[model samples]
Target: MTVIQWYPGHMAKAIRQVKENLKLVDIVLELVDARLPESSRNPQLEEILQNKLTIRVLTKADLADPKLNREWVDFYEAEGQPAIAINSNQGSLKAIENKIKSVMADKLLKRQEKGIINQRIKVMCIGIPNVGKSTLLNHLVKKNIAQTGNKPGVTKSQQWLKAGKTLQLLDTPGILWPKFEDPIVGKKLALTGAIKDTLYAKDDVALYALEYFVDNHPEKLKERYHLTDDEINDTTVNLLLNLTKKMGFKDDYDRASERLIFDIRKGKLGRYTLDFVPSSENDEA
Candidate 1:
């Protein structure tokens, strides 16, 4: 399998721009995919955002395991990272507003005591590509102001927009780290649509996702593809081949792979979470 990594030239420039603009924001809204919460997080951004109050916004809650979504949010909050899970398509924007207000209350209070009033809270929104940052921004501002798409690298520049009377948002392009040290992390991001489809092999990602479903969600997989118990029990590669034939693609495994990946991303196999909460250092990868 090819090593999965994607860091466009613009991303390096994005890092520099984020560092330069850090001082402008009162807090950082770090959006992550709820499906792969830990894997989708950019450690580089964590390093750059040192000492800033950050709200870990777990986006795409509607497509993730509902129980796991609660668990992940609790896990982050327990570790002292203020976190909330949101479905950017229709989740409560007021919840996001309240979280920002709660974190900035102390600082805003101090400024107001000195006679500063109606000061808009400045927020820097950062996340991996396609984690729904732009959709959240557009919803907050109640305008289709940010360019949004189902693919990565859509938002390539920094721009500021207002959200209600209390918030000013500085939206930044999504950043992927230079390398994925853990191969599974790369596959997880790819499976979740964080990496562009063209950057990696679809069959490889499909196989990775297939194994995950086989292990953790067999019933959903069986139901989605009408797999028999024996078919589900076959070797993973053979299962892919069988599925290709079953779908009437006549030996076109690559097309089957693409269809399987799309089904997973579109939640046709039901809500799933690729990254489990780490219980120890050895379990983290």
Candidate 2:
């Protein structure tokens, strides 16, 4: 399989540093976009933090389908993992705190048995860029303790925050894997805005997004633009252009495409998640 690898020198250094610092934390709170939970995960993380407990937080839940989010949560729980869907901007931090306590229950009990009182469980927050790690930190602490931006690579250094009496969070920069073994993985990352749009042409990204939406999420197109499946299949760009015109664009096809791309990125079409997990039958590929 051809892999797309783009790990900047700084990120490699960061990963090495994180690996070296993993011993300082008691748990890892791995943040992933709820919309693209499977695709958003960094596979290398499992190997790096092999023996540590991990609590997966699916951030940006408001922008993902509720039903799919529930399914994902169930999937994780069934695998003996703790997972929660949450929106960083909304009032979901309390639930996150409760889940953190739940995941660290065993460790907390061990500390209690050892006569350790008022011990704080240190958690390292790790995820890919734009997964809302910093936003989550701010929400949990009720203050802007971490530097946050709308784009990727905003948080560059690691800072520790006290989430509560029982938990402390080590916030780190969002990190991407050194390589994407699957092309679809790279495509989904781009589609979900994990990779900056400035790195590639909007039209090309939109084209791939258009095809994926048409194939896996035809109902979203129908609901968002009143486009029928046949209309969507006929011509993706033209269908988008017509929808843009109806939405009060200047009736220019190129402009319409641009607007459609913007809407897709901003979750205007609907809460949609892209799946890129390779099937078991095709695992060799």
Candidate 3:
């Protein structure tokens, strides 16, 4: 088991910033990867922002299994947390706006009863790096206000972006936990590009994904790579080699593995999720 770890100085500082800025926002827009919701969410978030109302967002819904997306939303809603799925790249953010309005209705109503006019809703968007926080921001603002890239740790600082008259957005760099208790969490994070590739072997990560597909999404794996039943049943390494050869990748397993991972990231292998069932059916904040 690879013990993947990455906690840069900036991330520590980001955590401190969350504490410092928690009170400034009326709600926390906690964005998490749709493909790996359980692993992408920082375990420390609920404890850290317990005093604030949070709306859990399942981001990159376009790249995850649609059924799992609904299931996750149901799970969070069952837990009493408001949840929604979005495809930021496709500008699917109207529901988030509606959700924000729904959650803040009572608060805004109270202000109106006190004769406060033109109430504004402030939200802080937080999540692990590369989970599309910036993309989501751009979707909501409909303008390129935040820097977005294909890798983790892109947003290195905090900035406030105004989204029209009544809603304000606080964009912060993604914060990940210091360490992963379960190695599988690390693998899932790596698979979803939450942790930087510099910290782990790309080939190994790709192999891990292939193994997961073999067990949980065999049809997808077979369909994408045209793997025979024998190949599917073979050892993972051997299956990878066979796939590499069939795809005319030459003798380069690493390149083939990279392509496999890239295809999965692009949803070429179909919409899949890496999260397992929650250990308990009980609701968690």
Which structure among the candidates has the greatest TM-score?
A: 1
Off by over 4 Å in 2: 1-5, 216-219, 222-230, 237-257, 276-285
Clashing pairs in 1: none
- The alpha-carbon RMSD values of the candidates against the true structure, listed in the order shown, are 1.8, 3.5, 2.8
Q: Which pairs of residues collide in model 2?
A: none
lDDT of 3 by residue, 1-285 (tens): 465576889999999999999989999999989899888999989799986888989899988889989989998998899999888687455667789889888988898899998767889999999999998898778899899998999999999998766678999998988888987788788777788877777678777898999999999988888888889999988888898898798788878877887888778888888885474554462
Ranking by lDDT: 1, 3, 2
Q: What lDDT tens digits, residue by residue, belong to model 1 across residues 72-91?
A: 99999999999999998875
lDDT of each: 0.90, 0.79, 0.86
| Candidates, ranked, TM-score | 1, 3, 2
Candidate 2 global lDDT: 0.79
The regions of model 1 sitting more than 4 angstroms off are 280-285
Best by lDDT: 1
